[model samples]
Target chain A: MTSQPEQGGGQAESLTRLTEQLSRLPGIGPRSAQRLAYHVIRAPKEETRELAEALLGVIETVRFCSICQNVTQTDPCPRCALPVEDQSIICVVEEPLDVVAIERSGAFKGRYHVLHGLLSPMDGVTPENLRIRELIERLRDDTVKEVIIATNPSMEGEVTAMYVQGLIAPLGVRVTRLARGLPSGSDLEFADAVTVARALEGRQEF
Target chain B: MSAIRVTKLSLTHFRNYAAQDFQPADGVTVLAGDNGQGKTNLLESLFILATGHSHRADTDREVIGWSAAREPIPYSRIAADVTAGDGRERVLELVMQLAPRGQAGEPTAVAERTIGPSGLRGGTLQKGYKVNGVRQRSASSVGDLAVVLAGPEEVDLFAGPPADRRRAIDSTALQTDAEYARELRRYERLVTQRNAALRDARERGSTQRTEDMRLWEQELIRAGALLLGHRITMIDVLQKEMLAAHTEFTGRTGHLALEYRSTVDIAGNGGASPDLQQSLADALEGAWGRDSATATTSVGPHRDDLRVVSGDVDLGVYGSRGQQRTAALALVIAQSAYIGQQLGDEPVILLDDPLSELDADRRERVLRHCLTPGRQVLITTADVELIPAEVRSHAAMYTVKNGRIEAA
Candidate 1:
């Protein structure tokens, strides 16, 4: 009887581990896990099997765009994978929000790469703490025209923009700072959509 | 010989004062008063005259009096006579009018601007430094005049986080050396960008982008190490001085130590070194997995904590109440000593009834050792008995009651 109980315990432990892993994803909590677990339990047996197959499909298929580092189900996320719309221009921004900000402006039909954060040394963030390598990589291509640095006009933002500008100056591509009229020390996410669009329109070279 | 002295000072319609004047003696002048009796306000005005900035960060409106009865608006003015290093006497005045806000946002001034030897409009607040009735672009010309204040807020040095201590240390360091502050500002900006980038990597679910992460890590290590080095050096000096002060005040034989506990494991790095850089790089790579798991920075000096300890016990924990007060006092005295050593003049010590927390034995020891010669000290207290007889005899005394200051 004890040997049989041990056999059942191994299966229960594996199930618990999976539940914990699922709950760890953003916006998923323990209660959500219970709901999801029940969904798996009560679904049509074939459909439940299909859901596991789909999960495995994504795990096997998704990869980062080699150029922009954006996640995609295919190589070179759709935006970066597309050809020669305008190879000369690149917009550098802090996050995907900034990418959205510039895209929504309907100006600068160029490409974009996101640097996640600004330099905040007190909080132990430095230039190496950001995605500046890929940015420098973008600079290596001579046809890449103006790199509009769309970092927020914060101290950290300005420092990052300056650091990146300094690193790529030898590459001879035009490095530019986003115009200052945008309010200082504010996150790009909070800026009114119109302000974000205009800032992009009026970017100036560093 | 001291370069500057405030010989006679007066205020009319100034914060909490209807009218007041004082003829400061040579060296130490202790201003005694209770809380809400306008002692700090009085000192603040003197500081404003010396440096254009108000130590109090509140807006100008709070500096003025507020009345609800549709009464006449109040006026805030400070007049001081200063003797320069060259033996020249100059009279400077600052005046601002206050008006009660109406239902609308408009405000009216009760008085116009005035400053002198001769009246001039807003001349006192020129861009950099004021001259003999002229404006100059350099505070360097204002000579080596400086003040160090140790009020209740400095308690944040120990009780508050590293950022608080960093700011406090940096502010004092800035006053003596402007270049250090500039480097700090540049370094701080870099950290923000680096952290934001790390956050984006997590949100985007791309840990394979090691090149991008590596770029930020390099810059972060460079800037972070510089700041860490400066802070560590400052803390080392501060620790030695503070421990001595703590012993004198508390008469305790226990050992006191200051530790800069960095979150990043750069123990032997000493800030800028190839090995340290590599260690940080390796740490960043390791932390990448965790950063993606939780879209927040998990490692680095930003999460650093500076600890003050007596033997094995953390001061914040097992230390007695008396030990805590003495530690607080020691920290301020240490800061003051650092400023004094750096600038060649002891900071003017302002004690706002700090003795209220101390027993008689400890209070006496504090007065004897902490109040060194050749330093300007101002202590405010309602209980006159707590003040040592030696201090009372040599000190310039003032009494404050009902917002009125009178010579004692």
Candidate 2:
């Protein structure tokens, strides 16, 4: 089933290994990986050395922030360290990308806690695999009032938020999910029936 | 239901047929053939073309011709030209081939024994759809062509396992209700995810109410409620039609009730959408302890049953073989009426050897039931003498021999 271009040993073996490693990345196929390898070989020496250094530099310098679990060079991410009007609010997100998405929206003014991953039971991903323990520990005090669960509306994301909500319920902190509805600039006429149904469900008062 | 009439059907490398084009008559078409001469295969292809699924085959790959490997691309196609009640003409196509788009390797099979004989390397058999030559997702093609097949296989519907019964209702809902496919898919996925959560809780030996288990349960409740609501509505429609159909076909006046025995306890067993969701939520919570212990969902639509009862005699459990066969026939006729009532266009009725078990009187009545004008019908029989003279006179007869069909 697997008909690859690797035939000989030594040079061919190393090149095949490189192609396999590169193809392991998301959206990069074996052909694209081989093309990348060829491009790297034709490039200048320092350029190749700089690419290797950049890859290593990220792994060595970057680490998950101890507070919110967002990737950062500092112990506590800048977002976690900054002061806000209300110290009693926390916006929980699934990953660092979610944090960036919410920050770009500028609609939220609370602190953020990145779970780093959603709760996927099928994949054997439990609460222990995520940053739920850290989140519960952060809620130990009565300082935080409301926790806005900014997880995506996917099934896994919904379960993860609900799990966090269940834990936070006893803590007396309020839990809320992001509203789901139609997209901006899209006509209601062209929207699919499910989208229209959800938009009607999440409709706000005029 | 929009009345659908299949004008022309073309099969290329399909099971038993290397290539065959057939034009069925408007009212009735009877396919006559001896056993194993591809009589049922014709009806099966029509079913696949109509519903995008084969009711008999365990896998869609089985429908691909064994000689399909001789073709350059190794693909099987079933295409049909249909006209609706308003005389709107359309073409629908379903193709089964190996490999995903663009990327190509060995044949696409993890372990297909049938494809193995072809000596093609491992490749996956993927099904693709086209509406009027325009690529369309299978989900978007709902209600394009509605079909009700009363085959011997579905006769076991009453005595069949829970999965088969659920699939029967789902199949009907899938073709008639346009929104049903998406909701059903969503509901199944949620059930899987919920089962995973329960299993995770059991594996971890969680002491404080398995983390995120309720969240998934809550999500499943919303989705499951929608599914239950649809099934209840579907059962109501089928119950009404089957009651009349059973009496008319069998000449028995006993009330035939199609009861949807749901796993979750909605307020009235099946209330309005909001009430149904709340009831499902309550039921899930009640079953959580057992569910977490067993690491499986205890209550959901997946565990429901469709009970076919004729005046206290549950056909699945207490009926005789003859009685079960009668009920199955009634159910198929009811499904046809239900699709017609729901879609406004009557579905194309394909009866594949349904008369073998029925006595002479009911056989003629059953054929007369489907002989309604403007409704296209296809009947496959091992012997043409079994068909009533009236039906035989009205039908455009065709003899099928070794996958070959000829007008008789």
Candidate 3:
């Protein structure tokens, strides 16, 4: 006979709900989600409380910066607050994490604009979903010179970058894209043919 | 020894084969059985293992045994233990499981092969490739067991549509250069993406082109140039290879030629030269007008053809049946030699009833040629006596009946 086990114990219902919610997260499958739920149930009460607090902490404090549209706790993200040598150059990216990637390189001391997503018609993603209007509004100033499209070299990423370029090009700002080639420290012999071809095409002056 | 000979092949829920394990000979093996006895099914499982798709099955699920529904889970598995070029042995496996329709997944050449137009009826077909227990894309494992298949149907290469000829060369390219497979998949996706972009623009009633169009065009050309360049270089090499084999096959070789005719001007450029890329770029740019009107790409390697010309006669148009058949056989032989020369691994030659139409003398010639020292040849036939005694003397013979295979 099929009986509701959760009827006798509310904890079973809570465990089921927790597994479902965890499974919805990226990279967490049903089995992993169930394992994670069980792990949470087994861990000490204080550790589980810390994880819950951390989750709430991010949602409560995280906000998009009004200027660059990157997730931040402040109205203007730290990157936007900083003064750079070039007000004209702004690197456009698909996500806030990309901003972190660029900052880690310690190069390109300029402004940044996060699009939040790429243009993917197949997945129903479109230009309207991204923060393109904010990017264009930032480019309205005559001081802005170049908008380098730093989206990933993927199909949807290219479409988003090109769409943004179309909007900014009319504002008289120069448009550019990140160079794609083989990664640094990779041996040429071991490099794939496609990567080698890209490196050859993007060869820089020695 | 053949570069990579399959020492053992195990199949389950595949075609008429409910469960079967085959051990091919090191030199030449013959499978003799009546029609509908699952002779070709064994070879087909090996073909799918080598190339990731059935040579004849329009859909991948067609390979699943009809009685497969009786099983708890309807699936087909083909696994092989191959002796690689260096005499090192490894396991390669492919599994096709039934999955619910409407599962959107990564676009792979193998997946594309499985799903046809009517395939959307939701027949569950999720195919995968595994190498040495670690899963990988079929493209990565294709050349692991390089095989050159010569069958009766293949004799129609010249008479068949240009698509068939293009596919023959593409198959060879896909096996020889793994990058070609990646580029091929990218090019296919680019074409679809480009067409979708064009359709979106048309729906929006836009007359002015956008930077996205230029971007797609640029990427398309870059990928297309590589495909065209590789095909041209390969066709040139195959022309000479096929010629030598043709000469040896029929003692007639002067007029046999594999001319790669392309929309791009490849007259001067050899291989994937800068000149060749420039030629493709110019061609695509020029065809953009026609493409915009058609909402599809009109020029590229997709439209190119590999023409087999016998002197002044175009074999596809006007070749005798015998000439076409011999040439097709030569093409397969040349392909095997080419794969061996390029990858330093002699490909296992699969001849599916190839000697059915040939005379005694020619069959002897083909048998002598295919069963040469160190080469692995697997040929199937209904008439066992057609095989010369000297040939059968050393061959590992097998008999198939009602989907069951047994050593002869």
Residues B195-302 of candidate 3 have per-residue lDDT tens digits of 777677767776456666666777778888899878877777788888987888775547798788887787755554457667777887787677776778777888
- Give the Cα error of residue B239 in candidate 3, in Å: 0.9
Model 3 chain B poorest ten-residue lDDT run: B106-115
Write model 2 residue lDDT over B1-408, tens digit each, in one string.
347999999988787888899999998999998888888888888788766677764656667786676554567898899888888888989997755223454332222222454334234567787778766545335567888888887776788787878877787888887667776777788788777877776676773565466566667777788888888877888888888877887786887788888777744644544478887887787887788788788788888888888778888999888778778888888888888887789999988888888899888778888888888999998888999888888889999988888998
Query: Which consecutive 10 residues in model 2 chain B have the weakest lDDT in total?
Result: B105-114
True contacts kept of 2: 0.32
* Model 2 local distance difference test score: 0.79
lDDT, candidates in the order shown:
0.63, 0.79, 0.77
Candidate 2: tens digits of C-alpha lDDT, residues A13-130: 7777777788677545555677788788889989999999999999999999898889998888777788876788899998888888888998888888999888887887878899
Candidate 2: misplaced stretches above 4 Å? A1-117, A131-153, A161-192, A199-206, B10-21, B34-42, B45-52, B61-78, B93-140, B266-275, B399-408
Q: What is the lDDT of residue B152 in candidate 3?
A: 61
- Candidate 1 deviant stretches above 4 angstroms: A1-206, B1-24, B42-146, B153-164, B187-222, B269-302, B401-404
The TM-score measured for candidate 1 stands at 0.54
Q: Return the TM-score for chain B, candidate 1.
A: 0.68
Give the root-mean-square deviation of each candidate in angstroms.
Answer: 17.5, 5.9, 7.8
lDDT of 1 by residue, B11-66 (tens): 76555676778777655666666678887777776655544445554334345443
Of the pair 1 and 2, which is ahead by TM-score? Answer: 2
Which candidate comes out best when scored by lDDT?
2
Q: What share of the true interface contacts does each candidate keep?
A: 0.04, 0.32, 0.08
All candidates in order of TM-score, best leading: 2, 3, 1
